[model samples]
Structure formats: structure tokens, C-alpha cells
Target: MDAAARARLIRALAGTVIAHADELTGLDQAIGDGDHGLNMKRGFETVLAEADTLAAQPLPAMLAGIGKTLVMRVGGASGPLYGTLFLTLGKTLPEESGMADAAPALEAAVAAVKARGKSDAGQKTMLDVLVPVLEELKAGGEGLPARLAATAHAAAEATVPMRAVRGRASFLGERSVGHMDPGARSSALMVEAVVTWLEEQA
Candidate 1:
């Protein structure tokens, strides 16, 4: 996607996070500190407020700025984890390209997030959703947004049966199994927002 499209996707993602903040907070309450929603909302609101400035930057610069804002404004582990994800993407992405060109950047982002969080897939973390989405992007095909939407949601749902081995939810043991990981849910929502914006572009 182009810069404008990227900006739109970010805006939509901010909206999605805000809209689902309460639900996210509730999910966190079941297994975490119950602040994921508020943290995400505040971070994304700052992103929205800085949208014009961000959109004006080069793609990498814009993404880096977004990551920085989230890191600075958001609370909890999510801030640093998500910040690293986006910052890595900014650093890794190639200039002037499409999803195919974005694949490596996204892949690098997954690794960065994994390292930053010191976590992996099937651990009831955001990686449950992100890893699969990265796979889909790397494969590169038509109806990308549709495929990403499905994969993201499915991965997020799959977290319902997983035991958290990382982050605050890890403290819950079996009790965390049935509850959806708030970070995974929020990751899915962010991906879904990207899909929505891409569909509009098409």
C-alpha cells in the first residue's frame, strides 16, 4: 500500500482499538492487569492526533514515528512489544513497493517482536495471530486483505485453547486457557483494520 493508504489503515486501526477498548480491558481483567484497553486507546489516540505529521514523513520515518508514539504513550508490556514490531518494520521495509516488497519487513518485524517479548507462537501471545499473518504475506497472493482477515481472526481464536507462557497472563496457568489473550485480540483487530482499509482501496 501507498503512504496515504498506510495512513488510512493506521487511522482505522486506531478506531478499532478505541471501539474495542472495553472488551479488551475485560479480557485483560481475566488474565492480566486490566489496563491493555486503556493503554491501547491512549496510544492510538496519540497516533491519530499526530496522523498528519506522520503521513508527511517518508514511509520508514512515518512507521518509526508511530512506533515511538506508542512506546512513549502506552503502558504495560504491549507498548514496547508493539513499538518494536512497528519500528522493525520501518527499518526493514524496502522503498517503493507492494505487499510482496513488504514481506521481508513484516517477517523481520515478527522476529523483532518475538525477541523483544522473548516469546513465540502457541504461547497465547500476539505471535499466535502475527506469525500466521506473516506467513500469509510471505506467500503473496490475491485477495490478500481477505486472507489476512481470516488468518488473523482464526489465529486469535486459536489462542482460546492455548496456555499463556509469557507476559502477565502466564501467571494464570490453566485459567488463562479459556480466556482470549488481549494482545492477540488487539493484534487481530489491528490486522482486520488493515484489511478493511485495503478493501476500500480495492
Candidate 2:
């Protein structure tokens, strides 16, 4: 992956968020704060806007702009969590590549997100999807891109059964059992987008 690929991922996520904004909000409305959809939509739009001006910078700089945008614009835990994820990726990523030379940067990002959110897999947070991706990357190393994608998708799917153990959804306790956490859903889609994009490249 390169800058274009990263930008494409953000762009796709933005579009998905917009298209499903109501659904996401509805999902959040059920178990968590009702703002997840709109919040995510706003953050990604900011990312797209910043992407326009970042053509000249390295991919890291471009994504860092997005990280800052989320930190300032998006409200709730997701803002800072995602901000940290992107910022960590930006800080650690190779200058010439994006997710192509991505295993280490992605690992760093998962760690950052976990640290920022104070949650992990089975907690029904973004880390559910993220942790598997990182593990696949670490285990499979550079050749794990496809496996990383698969793991993320599987992890996301797994969240459907697990009750929310952190964040706003946690308040629902047992009621959160059946439904998916909106944040985790969004994270899965984001990773799925990357996987689909990479498969296309192949």
C-alpha cells in the first residue's frame, strides 16, 4: 500500500459511514451512545478534506493530518482512540510505503489503539478486530496481508456474540449481548475495505 491506498481506505470508510450513518446511529442508539455514526462520519470527512492537501507529503504526514482531525473534531472515546491509531501508524510507517510495508506499522497501531482504549479482544471494542489483524501480521509477517485481512474480518464477525465489556455499550451489560458494538463494526468495515483493496491489487 502507498499513500493512494491509504487515502482510498479513508475515502471508502467515509463513504460507508455516510451511507450507513443512520444505521450506525441506530445501532449505537440501541446499546451505546447514539452518536457513533455521526461522529465517525464527521471524522472521516475531515480525513478526506485533509487528504486533498496532503498530496505532497509522505503517506504518514497525510494520515497524521487525519489523526489530528479526528482528535479535534470527533467526540467521545473513538476520537482519541482512532487518532492515536492513525498517529502511531503515521509515526512508525515507512516513508515510501503505506500498508504494503505495513506489518510493523499496523502492529504499532493495534498497540496504540489498545493502550488508548484500555480494552482488548473479547471486550467488544475495536480491538476485537484489530488484535487478530496484528497477530496475523506478526505471525505471518510480510506475507500475512491477506491473512491479516481475513483475521480482521473474522474478528469483526466474532463480535456479534460477545457482549460489550467496555465503553458506552458496556452499560447495557447483558442487553448488549446480541447486537454488535458500532465502533467495532466500523473498525471491521475499515479493515475489510483494506482487505478488499489489497485483493484487488493482487
Candidate 3:
């Protein structure tokens, strides 16, 4: 994607996070600390407020800055997990990248998140969404963005049936199975935003 596309994608992701803040919070209220939504909303709001400055920088630089901003502005597990996702990408990706070119960086980011959270796929964490998205991206096909978005949404929904094995929700044991994971939902939201932006580009 180009610089303009990168900025627009980030902004769209932020807006998506804000729009779904209440739902995310409600999900967390059922299984977690109930602060995921507000923390994510606050972090993304900072992204919006700093848009001009962010847009002025190179894409990687801008992403790195936004990651730092999230780490600084948001609290709870989300700030670091999400922040690391972007930070890893910003640091690993080339200055300009297409979906194919970005696969390795995206994979690396996912690995970093898994390591940082000490969790993995099927654990009812953000990995539920991110892993599928990465898999779809790696498995590339026509309309990749739409495919990845669908995978992300499906993975997020799949979390509802999974028993949490990590993080705060794990304490609830089988009780966590019926509730969606806020982090997974938010991760899907970010993927969906990318789909929307990509569609707009077409």
C-alpha cells in the first residue's frame, strides 16, 4: 500500500475500534477486566488526534509512532499486546509493502504477540483472530482483504466456544467458553477495517 493508503487504513482501524468500543467492553465484562474497550478507544483517539503528524512521516515510522502512542496511552493487557503487534510490523516490514511482501512481517508480529502473551492459537486470546488472518494472508487468493476479513470475523466468533487457557479469562475455566474474547473481537475489527479500506480503494 502507498503512504495515503497506510494512513487511511490506520484511521479506519481506529474508527472501527471506537465504534465497537461498547461491544468490546461488554464482552470483556463477561470474561475479563472490562477495560479493553475504553483503553482501545483512548489509544485510537490519540491516533486520530495525531493523524496529521503521523501522516507526515514514512509509513513504518508512523506505525512505530502509533504503537508507542498506544503503549503510552492505553492501559491493561491490550496496550502492550496491540502495541507490540504494530511495533513488530513497523520494525520488520520494508518501507513499502504489498500483502505478499508483508506476510513475513505479519507472521513475525503474530509470533511476537504469542510470545509476549505466552499464548497461542485456540487459547481464546487475540490469536484466535490474528492467526486466521495471517493464515489467510499467507494462503493468498483473489480478494485477499475480503478473505482475511472473513477469516478474522469467523475466528473472533469461534472464540465464544473456546475455553480460555490464558490471561484473565482463564481463571473462569469453562465459564469463559460462552463469552467472546474482547481482544479477538478487536483484532477482527482491525482486519475488517482493512477490508473496508481496501474495498474503498477499488
TM-scores, all candidates, are 0.96, 0.87, 0.96
Candidate 3 positional error at 141, Å: 1.6
Over 1-202, each residue of candidate 3 has an lDDT whose tens digit, in order, gives 5668767877898899999999999999999999999999999999988887887777778878889999999899999999899999889888876666678988999999999999999999999899888888898878787788889989999999999999999999999988989999999999899789889988
lDDT tens readout by residue for model 2, 1-202:
4657666666765676667778778878988889988998888777677665654467788767778888998888889998898888889887778445677898888888887788877898888888777767667656565676677767877887888889988888889888877877787777767666667677
lDDT of 1 by residue, 1-202 (tens): 4668767877897899999999999999999999999999999999999887787777787888889999999999999999998898888876565666677888899999999999999899999999999999878777777999999999999999899999998988999989899999999999999889878987
Higher lDDT: candidate 2 or 3? 3
Question: After superposition, which runs of candidate 1 have C-alpha atoms over 4 Å from their true positions?
Answer: 1-4
> What stretches of model 3 exceed 4 Å from their correct place?
1-3
What does each candidate score in C-alpha RMSD? Answer: 1.3, 2.4, 1.2
lDDT of 2 at 68: 86
Output the TM-score of candidate 2. Answer: 0.87
| Model 3 pairs in collision | none
